[model samples]
Target: MIGMAMRGEADIAIGPITRTAARLNVVDFLTPFQEEGIGFVMKKIDSPLLEQMFHVFRPISLVCWVAVVVSTVLTGIILTILAKLSPSAEHKEASLSRNLWIALSSILGQEDCPRPTFHQGYIILGFWWIFITLIMALYASSLAAFLTVPLPNAPLRNLEELASQTHYKPLVTQGTNLFHLFKSAKGGLHKRIWEMMSDMPKITVMDEAFSLVETGKYAFISDSSELRFELRNKCDELEIAQDSFLLTQLSFVVQKNFPFKDAFDHQ
Candidate 1:
């Protein structure tokens, strides 16, 4: 499933039809240069799932309570443990007298002692925890990048030009299923100079939306509708047609033999 391209088991498709993404393999899909909006549809029903998840965040405030409890317990524990930390020799050399000396030192005298080695061990453990977390985070990030397919180049003009160009490479999204109209635009060429000209070279493909523009030097094309909407939202220099045949649309259709088109219609 992954790396089918590396394995050399991929298939390329050419059609005068709408192309779906070839998500599983590497190849060319000669698809119609049509524009369409995509959407997600689901049954409508009210449910408590969204609300229940919101309540899960309520316990996040417990971090403050945990901090207070841990700090207070740590303060008391450290003070009690300070007695044992005085010196091992103090236990055999003297008993409560050393305690009295410590109390006196705290009140008016002074006590000199080396730092605790356990604190150093705690610092070392913290660093070890941070290092493991960083490694795991880096591994997950790398895996995500590895699994992702790069965006395919959009052929601003037509399909064949985008697929064949090397120096003027066009980037397309991964698995761009193109149609047959792009691969076979030559059958009726004498009267269609504009369509023929669109098949010219130097149209390197890229998937980024903003890569095409600057009308004089660069020409961008998509489904006429998409081009219209994109220019409306994008820069002023991008132009569209007033009376061009390049305008198009996409419709859902079933095969002539597929009787389910009538029997299994959308509600």
Candidate 2:
């Protein structure tokens, strides 16, 4: 790590470092830029309503809805025809038909008359059917749009990475050294990659130095700091590499309150 630092090629790095070894010989690790806190947060439990909605026979609910829609459409058509053809005389016809049956009691005791028109009833029912159908369509379209949009996973995997790009992807907790480190060093930082890191395993930023080594299958370490503001929730997940780096000091990039001529000063 010290040999690489001498060349000044590693533009960006975030990790723990003391003024020792090859770094002390020539390269500058700066003051501690950030400290790392590490731990794992398990996945959230699924909602009960959502879980039950996907259970077997759920399609039955959809089928019932479709059936109701079909029935309403048919009823609307029937009502439309009835409303266009019904007459005010239909009520009188029904009354006369009943009286005729009474007069024919000695004979067949029945009367012939057209059925009463239900035009007004049909018109009202049809209007309601159209309203319900429109609502259903709007709901379906909204659901489709929600399903189509893509949601991004959190960036920045662990504290070391958090130390470097933490300004962009790191999450911090109150009173954490990592939080203070980021607060100070965020103004200006450097970066670089190494050949050894290419084969390093992946690690989640659970705590200090978990990402220092690598597993056969994975090659990243994860970390986060200053969680309350926004980053902790955003960079909830991340992957980090196992390459060790020269830790830089957390220096403040004073923009508004630049006491010195340079923005990068001891914050």
Candidate 3:
């Protein structure tokens, strides 16, 4: 459409055609009717079922879990060994099973287990309590964050992030101004993304690009209004990014010295 207007083959082209400095050389655009920016259309991200189920345990590292288990066993063994060495009948009655129960219960924040009676038992139990207190505090502090925080499906929020990721394929219409916008952009995120897209297959149609976006692997960069319209009417799974890199004012394209330029601008 822009080509037709530029070549003077069409008197006027009515649509959301961006008016850039380069285009102004060949064609005149009426006062902008719509203002928008170039943004990506992506698929809505869904949290995984497995992640949701295990969210409670995600706060602590795997090494921490192993450490906790090892500490529990060691504390129980220490208690049992100390009890055997004690001469008192009450201390000697602390069997391996009883010591293990005490250790497990203390670690689990339970108070039902009997307290250690011997002096050595007291020292070992005191150290075990300190360790348990620290571990409990760490787990409690991180647990709330893991359980309540919502993880976004697409972690890429801006062009730089989108460009950095290989899993996300950002696309643009083959012949549109957006294609040229990136193609001519110099030495920045725009050029980087343009180079990335250059190696991949070209997307000629918005609908085709949108279909790929529905799969959640591809991102389509295009006019915000058009993308939003399609998102509302066709694909519910698609979403628009909050940040737009290229701001453009859209107007009807008319050939230079066209008779209706004045009338169109006045209206």
Best by lDDT: 3
Candidate 3, 101-152: lDDT as tens digits = 8889998778677878878888888889999999989999898776678555
Candidates 1 and 3, the one with greater lDDT: 3
Candidate 2 C-alpha error for residue 254, in Å: 28
For model 3, name the residue pairs that clash.
Answer: none
Which rank order by TM-score, best down to worst? 3, 2, 1
For model 1, how does the per-residue alpha-carbon lDDT over 96-214 read when each residue is reduced to its tens digit? 34333333333222446112234432343344335445544554565466447532223233433323333332212232232233344464431242343444444334334334333
Task: Output the lDDT of residue 90, model 3.
Answer: 82
Candidate 3 segments exceeding 4 Å error:
3-14, 33-35, 43-52, 89-94, 185-191, 198-204, 232-243, 252-267
Tell me the lDDT of candidate 3.
Answer: 0.82
Which lDDT values do the candidates have, in the order given? 0.36, 0.37, 0.82
Best by TM-score: 3
Poorest lDDT segment (10 consecutive residues) of candidate 1: 38-47
Candidate 1 root-mean-square deviation in Å: 21.4
Query: Cα RMSDs of all predictions?
Result: 21.4, 17.2, 3.8
Scanning candidate 2 in windows of ten residues, the lowest lDDT window is 213-222
